[model samples]
Target chain A: MLARLNVALLGLLASTLSFAGDAISATEKQPLNLHAIGMFVLFVSMTLGITYWAAGRTKSASDFYTAGGGITGFQNGLAIAGDYMSAATLLGLTALVYTKGVDGYIYMIAFFAGWPIILFLMAERLRNLGKFTFADITSYRLNQSKVRTMAAVSSLTVVCFYLVAQMVGAGQLIKLLFGLDYNIALFVVGALMMVYVTFGGMVATTWVQIIKACMLLAGGTLVAVLAMSQFGFSFEKMMGQAVSLHSLGEKLLFPGTLLPDPITALSLGLGLMFGTAGLPHILMRFFTVTNAKEARKSVLYASGFVAYFFNVILLMGFAAIIIVGQNPEFFEGGQIGGKIVGGGNMIAMHLAKAVGGNLLLGFLSAVAFATILAVVSGLALAGAAAISHDIYARVIRKGKATETEELRVSRFASVGLGLVAIVLGIAFEKMNVAFMVALAFGIAASANFPVLILSMYWKGLTTRGAVAGGYAGLVAAVLLVVFSKSVWVTVLGNAEALFPYDQPALFSMPLAFLITFIVSKLDNSAEAQAERAAFEDQYVRAQTGFGAAEASSH
Target chain B: MSTTASQNAVYARIRKNPRFAELVSKRQGFATLLSIIVLVIFYGFFMVVAFNPNLIGQRLSEGSYVTIGIAAELFMFIFFWVLTAVYVKRANGEFDEITAEIVRDASKEVK
Candidate 1:
C-alpha cells in the first residue's frame, strides 16, 4: 500500500505531460477497454468473495485488528509485499528508469534498504509489542493518554497525506486506463476500500494485498522475460542499449538524476530509509503474524519478493527506453510530447504494447488498478485504527471502552475516511504524486520515527518529551515542506522558497531527537521516574517476547 | 500488566537473570555490527553522490561502457539482502535459542 504511492508520484507527472487531456478525451469518446474491464471484474468478484468469508470470521477486536494472528509467514510476506507495492511504484519507478536512468535506481535501492533495518531492529520487537497500530509501541510504556493522543495525531497525519496521494493518482490513472471519468474512478476505489475495511477488516485487507502481490510479481516477471528475449537474456547488453539510447548517454548509468543536491540527497535518503519503520499501515502488518519469529521470517520473504520485483522493473525500464524511445508512434513531432499522449510515465505501458501487444497492455492496466485498491484498503484500515482504537478508545474512554464498541467505531471510521479521501482526491487531482508522498515520508521519519525509536531504545523518555518532541518534528516537517521548492515555488507559484532545502528530515529528525533527549534528562518528577523505570521491562518484553501478548484463539 | 509499578518491577527482575544478560549481549552485539555495515554501504553511496555526482557516470573499466556507480549499487543491493538473510538465519539458529533459554529461566523467577 505504501509502496504504490511511489507510483502516483511519477506516473502522473510523466503520463500527464504526454497526451494527458487528449487521452482523457479519447478514453471518454471510446468505451472502456473491454478485456481490461473483464479481468478487473473477475479479480473484484474473487476479492469480494474473500471479504464475505472474512466478514463472517471477523467477530472480536483481535480478529479485526490482527486477523486473530492466523496468517502464515509466506502469506504475511505477500501481504507486506502487497502493501509495499503501490500505484506510485508501478507508474513512478518505471517512469523514473525510463526517463531519468540510473538516478531512478536510487529510489528502488532506498525503498529496499529500509527493510533490513526493520528486520534487524524493529520487526521482531514490533510484532511482540504492537497489536493493531504502531502507535501502540510508541505509547507502550509512556503516559498512555498523552502519548497515545500524539501518536493518533501523527498517524492520522501520515495516513491522510498518503491516502490523498493514492486517491488522486488513482483518479487520474483510471481515467487513462479504463476511460472512466476521474470522479467515477475515485468513487469506485474509495467505496471498495471502505467495504474491505468496514466488513473484512485486516483479514480482507491482507487477502487483497496477498492477491495483488502475486499478480504484480507475475505481471512484472512476464514483462521482464519478454524484454529479455530482445537481448538473449544479457543484462550487460541491455544496460549498453539503455545508455546508448538515453539522452544522457553514458551519464544515464550514473546516480544523481532526481535530487543531485548534496544536502537534499542526504535528507531524502534519511526520510525514505527510516520512514518505513514508522508508517502506521506497514507496521500494523507485523501484528497479523503469530509471533516475533514469524515476523522476522515474513520480512525475509518480503525483502526477497520486493528485491526481485524492483530489479525486474528496473530491467523493464531500460527496455522501455530502447523499445519505446525510438518509436515516433509514441512521440509527437518526433519527440516525446510532455503534454501530448505518450511522453513520460506511459512509456512503460507503451513499451508493453510494443513488445507484447494489446493483451499484455490489458493485463498490466488491470494490475495497476488492482494495486491502487489493495493499497487504499491497507491505508484505510490503519487510519480507522488510529481514530477508533487510539483516539476514541484509549485516549477518550481511558481504556474503559469495550472491544465490540471499538470494532463498531473502526468500521464507522473507514466510511468516514473514504469520504474525506474522495474530496481530497479531487482537490489534489492535478498535484504531483511524488511530492505528496515525500511529504508523508518526511513527517513519518521526523515526527513518528524519532518519538517511537527514542521511546523504545532510550531509557529516559517521558510523556512530555514524547508529546513535545513529536509535535516539534511534525510541525517542522510540514512547515518546511510548505515553504520548500517542491511545493512553494512549483505549486504555489512563489518566486522563491522560504526554505532553501526541499527535505526537512535532516534538520527536523535531529531536532526531535535532541528535544526528547534534553527534556527527558531534565525530567525527574514521580511520573517521569516511573515511565523511565518502566523501560527496563519494556526492553525485555521487546527483546525476548516473554510477556508480549499472545495470539487469541477465539 | 495494568499497573505501571508492576511493569517496572518486571524489567528490574529480568535484569537480574543471567540468561537475559546473555540474550541481550549476543543479540545486540550482532545487530549493532550488521546495522553499521548496512549504514556504511548505503551512506557511502550517498557521500560519493554528494561530493561528485558525475563520478557515478565514469566508465567502470577502460571500455566496458557500464558506469562504475551502477555496478556498485547493484552490488550494494545484493549485499544488503545477503546481510539480512545472514542475520535472520543467525537470530533463528542462535539468538533465538538464547532467547528461549532466557525466557525459561526468567519465567520461574517472576512467578
Candidate 2:
C-alpha cells in the first residue's frame, strides 16, 4: 500500500512538472541571477556544516526532539523568532504594505499581539508540563491513547497545511528572486529539510533558525537604514511623500481601507493572536529551553525581535512606495506607475536594489530563501515529534518504546513528511494556496489551542470531552474553509460561498470552546472523576516545576 | 515507580504550601491582568478601525505629517515589548523565588 501511494505521488509530480515547465518557458525567460544564487549557495553550505556538527551530537530521542533541553534562554529566544518570521512575513507582508499602505501594519499588529498573551498565560505552564510535544501536556492526566491520538492528528494536520504553504511560497519566491526553476527549488528545499531534520534533528534545526534570524535581522536593518536614509530618517517626511505619491493618498494611512467589515477584522485579529500560541512548531520551541524562566525569556525576545522587524518592514514598505514605486527601472517595461517587474512582493527586493544596488538585492533574496527553509525545518521537526513521540511511543507502544526505537521512528517520519511536502508543493503550484495559511491558523486556534489551554487550566476537562471538542473544532474549521469564498468560489468554481467570512476563527473558535465547556460539564464518568482528581498533581508541577523534565547532561 | 510515588508526594505537599498558593494566585492575577491589558489595547484598536477609523487617520497636529493611527501603532509596538519585559522580570525573579522555596519545603516534608 505504501509503495502504491509513492507511485501515485510520483505520477502526480511528473504531470505537474511537465505542465509547469511549459508554463515557465512560455513566459519571458528571466536572466539567471548569479549574485543571488551565489549568496544562497554560501548560506546553504554554512547550514549544512552546522548540520554535520549537530548530527554528531544527536545521540538520543531527547536530543532529536528538544536538543537535550540544554539550550539557553537567549538562544532559544532567537530560534523562536526565526520560527515565527517566515518568508511570507518578509515578502507577502511587505507586498501588503506596498499596495495597501498602513493596512499592512495593522495586520502585523494583530500578528504580534499573540506573543504577550503566550508569555503571560501559556509559556511557563507549557515548559513545566510538556516533555517533547504539546501532546505530552494535554494527555498528561487523560486517557493517554485517546487524547494523544486526537492531539497528534490535529498537530499533524496543522503541520502539513503550514508546510505546504511554506513550500509553495518558497518555490515561487525563489523562482522570482534567483531565477531558479520551481521544481529544482522545491527539491533542494525538501532535500535539505529532510537532511537537517532526519540527521541533525532539533539541534541542527535550532542553530539553522538562529542563524537565519540573525541574517534576516541584519538584512532587514540594512534595507531599512539605507532606504530611510533617503528620507532623512524622518517618518513624517516619508509618510508625507508616500501620501502624495500613493493612489489612495490620505486614506492609505488609516484602517478602514484594509478590512472591509467589523466581523472580519475581529476574526482575523483573534485568529492571528491565538493561532501563534497553538502552532505546534512554535509551541515545541518552549521545550527546547531549560525551564519556565528560559521559556518566558524566549517569548520576550521573540516578541521584541518580531515587533522590531515589523517596524523595519513599515519603513521598507513606505520607502518602496517612493523608492521602488516611483522608479521606472523597477517597473515592467519602464512603466513607472504600472505593474512591478516581478510582481508586488518584489517591492522590498526592488527597494533593496534601488538603495544599495545588486549587492543588497542578492543578500535580501538569499535571506528570503533561508527564512522559508528554517520555517519548514521547524514544522517538519514538529510533525515528526507528533508522529514518533505522541503516536508511536506513547499511544501505539503504550510507553514501551525504547529511546533508540523512538529516535529511529522520528528520523523516518521526518523524511516521510519532507517527501509529502515536496509533492504537494509541486502539485499545488498552479492553484491558489494562500488560503492554506489562514486555514492552518484557523485549525490551530480552534482545535489545538482550546484543548491545550483547557487541559492546563481547567480541572474538569475529561478525555471524552477533549477528544470530542478537538475533533469538532478540526472538522468545523476545515469545513468552513472549504465553504468560504476563497476556496468555494475562487478555487472550486462555485457560484456563492456558504460561509460569509474568509476567517472561520470568529465562528469556529467559539463553537469549540462552548462545546468543550458544555461537554466537560456534562461528563460524569468515574474516569472523569479520576482525571479531575489527578489535576492537582499536574497543577503543582505546572506551578513549580517540581518533577518536570530536566535538561539532560551530556 | 517508587521515585514517581515520592514525586507525587512532594507535589501534594507543594500544593498545600501557603507559598505555593500565594505564588499561583499572584502569578495568575498578574497574568490575567496583563492579558486583559493586551487584549483591550489590540481589540480596542480593532474596534476603532471598525467603527471610527477617521479618528486614527487624523494627523497628530496641524503641522506634523504623521497620522494619529501610525503614532498609536508605533507606541504600541514599543509599549507591548515593555509589558513583556515587565512580566518576565517579575515572574523570573519574585515568583521564581517563591516557587523555589515552596519546592524545597515540600521536598523536605516528603523526606
DockQ top scorer: 2
TM-score of each: 0.93, 0.96
Query: How accurately is candidate 2 docked according to DockQ?
Result: 0.74
DockQ of each: 0.62, 0.74
Distance from true location, Cα of A533 in model 2, Å: 0.3
Runs off by more than 4 Å, candidate 2: A1-29, B1-3
Lowest summed lDDT window (length 10), candidate 2 chain A? A1-10
Q: After superposition, how far is residue A53 of candidate 1 from its true place, in Å?
A: 0.7
- Cα error of candidate 1 at position A380, Å: 0.7
Candidate 2, A335-369: lDDT as tens digits: 98898887777888898899998899899998998
Output the number of the TM-score-best candidate: 2
C-alpha lDDT values of all predictions: 0.82, 0.89
lDDT by residue for model 1 (A372-488), tens? 999999999999999998998999898889999999999999999999999999988777656778888889998999888887788889988998999999998999999998899
